[model samples]
Target: MPFLIVNTTVTFVALLSFRLLVKRMYALVSNSKQESYNVLIVGVNDDSIALAEALSTSKNQNFNLAGFISFRKDHQRIKILGKPIIKYGSKFYDRIAPMKITGIIIAGAQLSITQKNELVDKALANNLKIFSVPEITQWTDKEDVTSKIKEIQIEDLLERDAIHLDDSEISNYLKNRIVLITGGAGSIGSEIVRQVSSYQPECILILDQAESPLYDLELELKEKFPDVHYEVILGDVRCRERILNVFKNHDISVVFHAAAYKHVPMIEKNPKEAVAVNIMGTVNLADLSTQFNIDRFVMVSTDKAVNPTNVMGASKRAAEMYVQALQQNDNVSTKFITTRFGNVLGSNGSVIPYFKKQIENGGPVTVTHQDIIRYFMTIPEACQLVLQAGTMGNGGEIFVFDMGKPVRIMDLAERMIKLSGFQPYQDIDIKIIGLRPGEKLYEELLSDNSTTLPTHHKKIMIAKDKPLDYNIVCIHMEDISNAADSENDSFIVSKIKQLVPEFISKNSVFELLDKKINL
Candidate 1:
């Protein structure tokens, strides 16, 4: 009886100590969280629950979970982790500051664009920063949960569902192959370099004229993809001797030809540079790829290439024709494919960043035309589609991506202002400037004679290309190249028009050339 009493006493003391320890831990957690910035989590679903659980732990260094924001009014009764979920409304907007909320974390992928816009406008008004969890595919278990919450980007707002990719096909084409990406320092080319590196290529040859951007890309690749081998060549695509040296030195199997003059207004002003770079640069690559017997040659073209109205567009179309015609040649063995896409969302000099800067300046935002609309895809999406197209093309095909509903420039400007915590026209005036030279109100993916046929990939389609005669295309391309050498803008543009009969100049001095042709 004495032994039993002694045992019970010891057990009781141990239980009491354990309970005290639990109390102490709770106190510490409470104290630390009090010192942290309080954050509200939007959309309390599976994703948000995971985020909340992570933030609840001591591992989250920056934020303390305050409450949840519910999209549905009925979700108010739902309590997650002993915290009440408040329905988002006008009342909630007023309570944001009072609640000590410093930030909002959007975790719902199903949230519509309209809801996102409303949330952004309200959050910015409250002087709160907005964050979002990255897509599930973007993170690994080893990655820190808090680090995955990134600032909500404008690309996230305009982008659609993540595109489906055929991993095996892309890997098969890119893996262990020596890849050459022309214009590798440009926005599109840089993204292509980043994406292709993930596929484990043999070595990536980054050829470009821009020294600073190329150096920056090298630093990024070393940090992000340390294992990927790359060579940065400071050379222009316009130089045949320089290009020939690159081809001779590297056993380049795959060519992603992204080198070209893209700005419509600038290209319209100097048609010589347009023809030299867009036409002859493409010609040099195409000829070299065929001569060296490269496996696949993929050229990145623009939607403006269809029924081109500017020197830039016309030149791109000319390049597209030359590439298509090469595939028709019985003597050529290389497969040349072209992928045409619309405006990349945040590329250099794109309207999104331009508007963002104007909004930051706190004044009038410029819109070329009130009715102008354009389809946009994120840079990564465009590059991903380019890779997918590269894998599927047999030869002589122009691939077009299905860019979802076009966005109006006027509406975009207003939404941007509101999202920046200001009222449009009241706080920031939107001035309508007339269309610049060679600018179009609408862009078309397919021409009158061409029709799209469905590919195995749902998002990509093959345009029934009417390939120009190989010999005839070569002769005209050579003539344009000669005119470019003479630095004759009118003569070069005339040759381009003759080469691409669909070419028509708009809002440009070259409109007079079109008139002359008609007369």
Candidate 2:
């Protein structure tokens, strides 16, 4: 009887307090001299209605309910809480202008960034502020919707619609399966780990040479997924013994090979290490995967590997050829898959972080060339596509991602400046530094003669390139490996040229090899 009475008392007190708070808020808004800005709520869903109620009762009294706008063609409701609900159309601005709508609040997260951007652009042109409510999953009982509202970010401007995936297909393949991710601490690799974890893998072995990043990743995965078993192995991919031990210890069914030296200029200077890691290291994993009879081996490739001009690009091309040839072996059981994409936004080595750092220092943001361009994908999006493609690959097929349109580096700098609330070349200067060694004006997803076949997924395609003999490719790789070990730069480049005839050097010492070959 006492427990029931206490519960009733608590419930009554909570309701009484809320009523008093609402009454006090109404009084505060009535007495305030500041004018309430007329606002239009986007969407007429439950989230929109809830947000409207919260805004109406908020103590800030900054927004006044003007009306609701519906994107749906069949939304028949004419009014919500006495405010007129209007359908969005070509005359959207014409309808809202009469009401003097000063702000627009996007109510739900169902709208794509492209759609939101269109709305945001129109609102900005008309001198109206724009805000978006957080997704339902992000909401908490203690926090109000108004508090979760925020201005759109630059990433929103670049985002595309979410990629569709066969969750059941992916889950079935991964459930209770032991998986291994090389370089699992890096940007792309870490995201792959996160995405794969959700599929309920039996165990995940994270192998990376970087101690700090590996430890951090371990801590994060442990905290985020306490139920999923994870083991962090701090070792280089070049160490065959260590990798073999990892494979021997765990019955890894799937392997994501993402470990490679990717920095163009740095790798150009140290081609020997690039050859050893990107080429020889990949060879190590492929050989072991085949020997161990692993089910799948997915290699993370790059757009640079297409008609490559840089040492890093050529090395990756050599690895791709080796892996492709491995599938031709009659004795091999593993299905080798390769995913090729361009620059990932906000990666540790990407220009986005470099520009951000330069901007934070209050000075010039350096661009390699005014005309240089590159395709970009978000880290998560790229990793998700990698998983999707990995599941869909048959064998010996290179999956090239459709990275939308190429973005000019100069325009990117300007966008970054504007997003930071600064005028380009006025408040922040974007200096054009000359291109570095081995750097190109643009990146290619496929070579001149290469063609792509469409897949079930719209965003991914299979690149059809002439197959090279496994034995011949292995012979060239062996020579390249020996040259790399001997630190013979000329021989290494020569062997790479033999393996990838399209490997032309640009603005570097290896350019002499191309001239000599022509002679």
Candidate 3:
């Protein structure tokens, strides 16, 4: 009877101490809430719960969790670590407004683009700050999860669903292979380099004439991918001797040829340079690849190459033809593949940067044409598609990415203005400038005569075009190359038109050539 009493007394004292500690911790948390920023998290799934727990313990004491905003209907009404899920959908406005919520945290990748836009617009209206979780693929551990929360950008608003890639297939093709990227410093080429580096290639030879960008890329690779062997060659693709030397020195088996002059108006102004670089430069590379018995040669082409109406597009189309013709050579060993894609957002010389500059100048944002519609994909997405296309190609296949519905320039301008926290036309004026030379109303991924063949991946398709006579293509290419050497603009334009019969000029000086041919 005495032993039992003693045990009961000890248990009672321990329980009393634990209760006191719990009360003390709750009081401290309640006190902190008064000074902290109240945050309501979006989504109620496992990721959201994990994010809330991470934020609660973060060193940055600014964020205080208020509750949850249910994104998943099934997970609704459930408490996340004892925090109430007070509101969802339209009901959130009343509850959130009353809670004195200062910020919103979109905590999971389950939120759709439409949903995000609605929520973000509402948050902006309420004058509340907004942050979104990183992509689930990017998350690995509990540490640093809060650091991934960032202020959303216009690009984020326009992002499509994450692309699921065939990692095994890509690894098999790229592993231990000596790869070469021609324009390695440019936006698209640089992204290609970054993604390809992760696959453990034997070595990557970055060949570009630009020194500063190449240097920057080398430094970045050194920091991020120290184990990957890479060589930065300061050389232009136009130089046959320089390219030949590099190929001779390195055991280059796979080549991603991304070098070319891409600006349409600039190429229109200097047709000879466009021909020399886009066409002949490609010829130089293709010829060398064939000579070297390269395992795979993937040329990056543009959507403008379809029924081309400008110097840049015609030049790219001509390059495509030359590369395609090379496959017909009975003695050729290289499998030449061309991957055509639309404009990549954030690429140098793209309209997004130009519009951003115009917006920053605090005046009118210029649009080439109000109705002009073009397809757009993020730089990383386009490069991944390029790599995937390279893996899927058997020989001489032109792969076109399935860029979703075309977006109007006017709509894009308005959205960008709104994303910048300004009202379109009220805060910032939009001016519709006439189409520049070589500009088009719309872009085409395939020509009128071409048809698409479905691939294993839904986002990519094969464009089967009419077969070109290799001998004839060679003759025209030779003439164009000779004309380029002569630096005769009219002669080069004439030869390109003759070479690509579909090369019709638009708002350009070469339009007269089209009229003359028609007459």
Which candidate's TM-score is highest?
3
Q: Arrange candidates by TM-score, descending.
A: 3, 1, 2
Root-mean-square deviation per candidate? 8.5, 6.3, 9.0
Local accuracy of candidate 3 as per-residue lDDT tens digits, 432-470: 889999889999999999999999999999999865889
Off by over 4 Å in 3: 1-38, 59-64, 72-83, 121-129, 135-146
lDDT of 1 by residue, 350-463 (tens): 999999999999979999999999999999999999999999867889999999889898988987886666789999999999999999999989998899999999999998
In candidate 1, position 293 carries an lDDT of 96
* Candidate number of the best lDDT: 1
lDDT of 1 at 255: 98
| 1 against 2, candidate with superior lDDT | 1
Q: Could you tell me how far off, in angstroms, the CA of residue 228 lies in candidate 3 after the best superposition?
A: 0.7
Give the runs in model 1 whose Cα sits over 4 Å from its true position.
Answer: 1-39, 53-64, 71-75, 87-103, 108-129, 135-151
Error of 1 at 445 (Å): 0.7
| Each prediction's number of clashing residue pairs | 0, 0, 0
TM-score of each: 0.86, 0.84, 0.88
